[model samples]
Target: MNAEIIAVGTELLLGQIANTNAQYLSSELAQLGINVFYHTAVGDNSSRLKDVIKGAQQRSNLIIFTGGLGPTKDDLTKETVASVLSVELEHDQKALNQIEQYFQRTNRHMTENNKKQALVLKGATVFPNDNGMAPGIAYKNKDCLYLLFPGPPSELKLMFDKYGRSFLLEQLETKQFMESRVLRFFGIGESQLETEIEDLIDSQKNPTIAPLAGEGEVTLRLTAKDNSLDRVTEMLNKVEEEIQRRVGTFFYGYGTTSLHSELFKKLQEKKLTISSAESLTGGSFANELTSFNGASLVYQGSIVCYQNEVKEKLLNVSPQVIKEHGAVSFECAKQMAEQVRQTLNSDIGVSFTGVAGPAEQEGKPVGTVFIGISIKNSKTEVYTLKLSGSRNGIRNRAVKYANFYLLKLLS
Candidate 1:
């Protein structure tokens, strides 16, 4: 089914709030095999909303609206929809009872205007709200379907998941199953990754390959549809294998897994302890690793040696090496990694030293990074990187590179 999402709120146009509801609904509809053709956001004005609704009816078979469902005067979403469809508005008794009980339970005064929350479009399927007072409505006008949800994200998400999804499924003429797999890759540019698998994308039929570039990473979403679940899974596996063969080295874990989480899991599984000696990142690498639970088992500790004095005193970097090769040099990183690992008695040690700044440091240009990895029973390895971005971006990417290198080592 072709669908269009209309977000109704003055706050959205004024930039007071984001229109994330449209984004959520679009993703959910895609999973249900519905095509979202357009997203339109309008203020809480009747005339403009009427125009938007009429335009949506002409082009899309399904129109979904979010926001402007409150007890205030500006909450005109249901009224506008009812007016456009030439249908009457009636109060839903069950919703009214719920609202009354809420007021009584809180010992608050219930004004006459508050009863407006119970009003819904006539002949519409009522979706009772579990989180808030505003009830959702779904109406079918001839060949077009209209769904109205509340403004708050909590209310809208619960209502849609509990009732709205099943209602849409029942409305579909044919039953089809859809499955999607997201393959995540790091340490590669989006353009290069796409170029490697451009043939697979162009000749896609049953399973579609769509590449998306995220912050510091790229993802390929493989979506397959069929009447039988087994056939859909087979199609996805086939496409994934071909894509993996082309760019498997850069591919990491699946779905929303990040480098830190994957690394933590691997360390725990292998029972390896880790420590960090952070210079430019200032313990950010340690912070990312320890954010996951049970990090104490895998993480030993971290030493933030931001200054040369601390590097020498804590991480035991020689003063001569800092004066000659500079603190942001390979020798400094290597020493820091080995010393931290030996100091904390961990199986692995990682170090980050770089110039990530507003100005160059020690005759080195900005974005010049050095990452060192030292593992027990192996030689130390240091990787050099020349990156480009703001100071914070460079620092963040440096930490990510450390995680990626360590992950590769452990794998």
Candidate 2:
């Protein structure tokens, strides 16, 4: 299962955007037990791409390509790949209909060049893109397997996950299904979490542990392969129990769950609605809570008090409180939270007030933050934090910290 991920885009070479497709595909391939040894990115040039493909063919059995599937002339991935496979391109009528319908549905004229996207390698399996115009293709030529995807990550990700994955599994004749569970954790660094379960990672055999860190959180992906689904579940749960024994305090939720989403669940279970009064974070704190559908069950509303006047006029923060302790102070944060709850008639209220900037406010340093929470009858609590990052990072972390505290308080 040796594979090489070839990303084709002049934009990628120019550093206009990241080659995230490579990273994503590599991770998914690993879950399928495919060994991705090389990741190569080339411009829209066919000769260079051909050379890369020839080299990949010499070493790898699976060649997966992303990018260059578009209406423009610069999009040459399919052409280059078809040439390498010694095949001609033929129009896929379904793909053509998709493009035609897309243009008509959006009330835009379909150009002649746009038809180029409907062309696929002859004798290739076509994956119709639900999100975009270009179609993904897969062809098994002798001993080598080739999969091509659209350049845009949105299209590529959906096509691969929804259709391409199953096709690959069938091509590989995989009997055992690979089951994966991602245990998400906050308030724990990757190194610390790994060290706590280093022995298990060291002795991994049937179930494998991979630790990944991203944006203020860490996750351990436990993967197990077994013919029986129940056996795979048992294996993963067994590993999870052992890991939880060591670092259960930080474990929050599972696969793709965020801190805010987990907190939203708890609020729903308690049948309590929440609101927010935000300052330095703007409406970001509220935005996080509302990102999930049905969040309104637990989230009432929010007030973005960017200025002192707004705080006084809308959320009814006393002018004296602002003058005495400043807007970024803990006293002001608590008052804002309490006032928002009273104003919105929500069961719980949260507030974020911070100096997240290039300059300090009220003599407090940048990244100085105070997150406040108010329950119906409980005393209002404020968590003070001195974080370090860019202004956006500081603001983003404020929302995360708020979610963390709310989860802990509820627990």
Using TM-score as the measure, the top candidate is 1
Error of 2 at 282 (Å): 3.3
Candidate 1 per-residue C-alpha lDDT over 329-405 given as tens digits, one digit per residue, 9 for 90 to 100: 99999999999999999999999999998999999999999999999999999999999999999999998888888
TM-scores for every predicted model: 0.93, 0.72
10 residues in a row with least lDDT, candidate 2? 171-180
Candidate 1: C-alpha RMSD to true structure equals 2.1
On the 0 to 100 scale, the lDDT of residue 300 in model 2 is 87
TM-score of 1: 0.93
**lDDT for position 277 in model 1:** 97
Clashes of each: 0, 1
